[model samples]
Target: MEYMKNYKHWLANVKEEERAELVALASDEKELKERFALPLAFGTAGMRGTLGLGTFRMNEYTVARATQGLADYIKEQGKDAMERGVVISYDTRRMSYEFAMKAARVLAANGVNAYLFENVRPVPICSFAVGYLGTFSGIMITASHNPKEYNGYKVYGSDGAQLSPEATARVVSFIEKRDYFGVPEATVDPSRENVMGKDNVKLCDHITVMGKSVDEAYFDRIAKLSLSPEAVAKEGGNLKIVYTPLHGSGYKPVTEILSRMQIPYNVVPEQAEPDPEFPTVKMPNPEMPDALTLGIKLAETLGSDVVIGTDPDADRMGVAVRTNKGEFVLLTGNQTGVLLMDYILRRHKEKGTLPQNAAVVKTIVTTSLAEKVAASYGAACYDVLTGFKFIGEKIDLFQKTGAHTFLFGYEESYGYLAGTHAKDKDAVVSTMLFAEMVCYYKSVGVSLYDRLQEIYKTLGYYAEKTISVYFKGLDGMEIMANKTKALRKVDIREIAGWKVASTVDFLAGEKTYSSGKKEKIDFPKSDVMKYFLEGGDWVAIRPSGTEPKLKLYVSASATTAEKAAEKAAALLDQMKGYVE
Candidate 1:
């Protein structure tokens, strides 16, 4: 088959040590087929994979080719594209700097000015750099929370959101239309196109590539997110706090903000330094228990009242706090979002700072506890598709029309932002707000867990659960497709023991109420299914937008927290069988 020959050709391109690795992998045909067949597909988020020679792998050549494609695309737009330029930043991942510089060279070879960061930076900084420099686009080379073996490239438009649907379509068109990767070299070689006049193409192929002075201004941009440095100044060092970056890019900016606020906190040394292999964490995600093991242990050692951990890219944060009963329980991502959402708006109203046009934005799958809170403040709440980019798009809209003043935005997956300054989810801002929340509760003679109980008592108790079913390869894709199709064919009457009150299918862009009413959904079509149960409980099903898996999101509201969590879990268990 042509596929096999292509695999051999890709293998032939590897260097001495890398070729040996690919050759060793070649003995196993089944493994080799899995590795080489799919050449990594760059979706809305861009390319991500383990480092190797296969088409599906992320290696030097593939990065160069993808960079070349993006470069050619920008060049097609002419001199304006060059004037607009591209901003590049990396994280702590292995080969991240190399990829960032390689991408810069490609963009530069085509007369596009590349404003590369001198060192590793967070995702929000990359977004900030593009906007701050008045650049045309942005590139970030870091997989948000995946294991250390992985790396990714994400593109952002001039407005600072992830490339929109139309722009995404054009970029893909540019990539697919390119027929000249290895055919010929460019008229102006990429090696000599650096702003620092350093030969980036040859020296930093693997890289300490020279970078322009773009970081100080980037930091100044996110600094506008501070709503109360005075509160932080007055309450400084009153409450003890613990944090960990999980051996990633979060450490620098996170420490910078906490230090600037004069907050009393201790960083977990094991995770303070940047290690691309992520030595301290089994999984780099803050939501996962193992990822925060060292963090929790350090929190206990410091006798700290609160613990916070951010993922590798610093886009999300997970928190744990001591209960009134002296037990430390980790808060779910939904719980964290609700707490911050309630805190921001409620505090604003009390301080006479709540804007009349204030509003919050959340993904469709996030909790409705926020909806109840938003309504209580007479502010509107809008739900968009899953990614933070959708929330960013809404921010751009609010900026143009005073339709809604962007108050807060969050997702149940531990991603959040306090203000509209950074379009993307930001742990730097989250680190500041969440730590301040800890002190606020402590000053009131209660722990965060006690405050959560108060919220449960006032509003209803809310519980959320998420489960992902991994489906690999082409055959698995078919299975997942058929299973999702079947779920839409019938009305789900019961999940566990709760009666299903309504069904909403985003794929069909329709909602069917129990009373036989149907309404159209205005969002883009996605293969996600959601059901409402009696007494304000909800369950949603959709495949993972980033990974190859089917995910189940369930949220329940009840009089008691224990009952809500139990009922929510039972619902997912039964729904699994219902689908089976």
Candidate 2:
């Protein structure tokens, strides 16, 4: 009944095109109900949803409401905070720029200065700008790697990381206090004046359009993160790397860095430009095989040794390398993480810059091979929750307490970060590092794939597979919730014939042993469950905090490669069966 009222409200006030779409949706009860039944949920990662005309969808109304809430929170921090303002950037998704400007306008209306990027930029740049400009907060309008019809609004703190849960909760509380339709809307007249000396200063009174000054500052810091500059200088001209931005925001920064480093590289021309429709790929995500098809084809044509693809906002990256067998093979996020981990450590040790307190951070679901590689070099490894915010949090914590020195951090979802230049996962930094990595290995007469095999040979062979089951519509949410709840009640002694060593419930913050003993897990509480099996293998299940899906991750390690792959596959199948 309330949704019916909300439907009428939108039908009366929305744009002509949106009004027509709403009228059509009204005829379909299921779709109408799904769109109007609830407001889009906001969490630590902010909000993501399909773009359309409803409270449940990502439209100007929803974006405006979120921006107003953030503005209100900023205003509450007092006049100085309001003056410091918020930085805003967007990727190349439909309405991304429009939504970003709308947010800037809202903040401007509230007497808060807004720093808006002149054009689309990667997420890490926005993060860096937050700290660089000493802004109160930052906003990024992107759906990340999602399909074309989707867009999202992510908020970042002054520390240049995604807002922590407590801060997000406060923002959500502010959001809930405001009416979606009643949020004030304002306007901004953007100009492209080349203010060289004042590139990042406010132009029209309240909103500033940032220019090359910010980019140069960000690039300078990213350049310092390179572990092997000599190797890059020696082999850069012969690296033969191919990169694709997937029609998003990575093109400029990614290409700029590659060229500046003097690395021989080619861009997949088809996806080099910014296209909100993402015409070349079904999904702009590099994690998918099809997303890299065009780039891989270009690499093959040019006899390139490696291919790299960045997602829409350039926060995540995917890679493929030419093998010694004269074939190209894709590397999973886990493989790439460990390869980089091993390389970073090896190079640091060789250079005598390897810190005695060096430590790497990864999510629990990531490959355990990183831990092995870290241990081999006497570097500590820490596992955090799934999001890169936790990794950023660890970085901040390490800086505060000096308990451990943060070296590198990554998640299994193609997100990686190095150095404190940017708090979030930075594909630009990762892309440059991978090029240097490739060039270094090539100088030694080996491909990245061969180096990966060598890593497996040195450490135990590790294989990991992540599967996601999407549950759509209203019923889907309930189904996912019930399944996770039921799974928490399960006390399985074995999975796919492997004996269980223990079960760790992140939600309860406890690990239960087969003998009925329980010990508290030191990590933060999350809606995740992990089953540790014999031989150091494990499986984890968690509902996606940002998407309408349940994710299952299975990681296995064995003395032999074939056995590890087999065990991982079997564990994944068994976990899928349980969820179904």
Compared with the true structure, all predictions reach lDDT values of 0.78, 0.89
How much does candidate 2 score in TM-score? Answer: 0.97
Model 1 lowest lDDT segment of ten:
199-208
lDDT of 1 by residue, 152-257 (tens): 8888888878888777777777776553235222243355434343323333222223333455565565566555555556666776778898888888788877
**Cα lDDT tens digits for candidate 2, 186-267:** 4534353333345666656688888798999999988988888888889998778889999989999999999999987888
lDDT of 2: 0.89
What are the RMSDs of all candidates, in order? Answer: 3.4, 1.8
Where is model 1 more than 4 Å wrong at Cα?
179-214, 444-446
Clash pairs for candidate 2: none
Q: How far is candidate 2 from the true structure (C-alpha RMSD, Å)?
A: 1.8
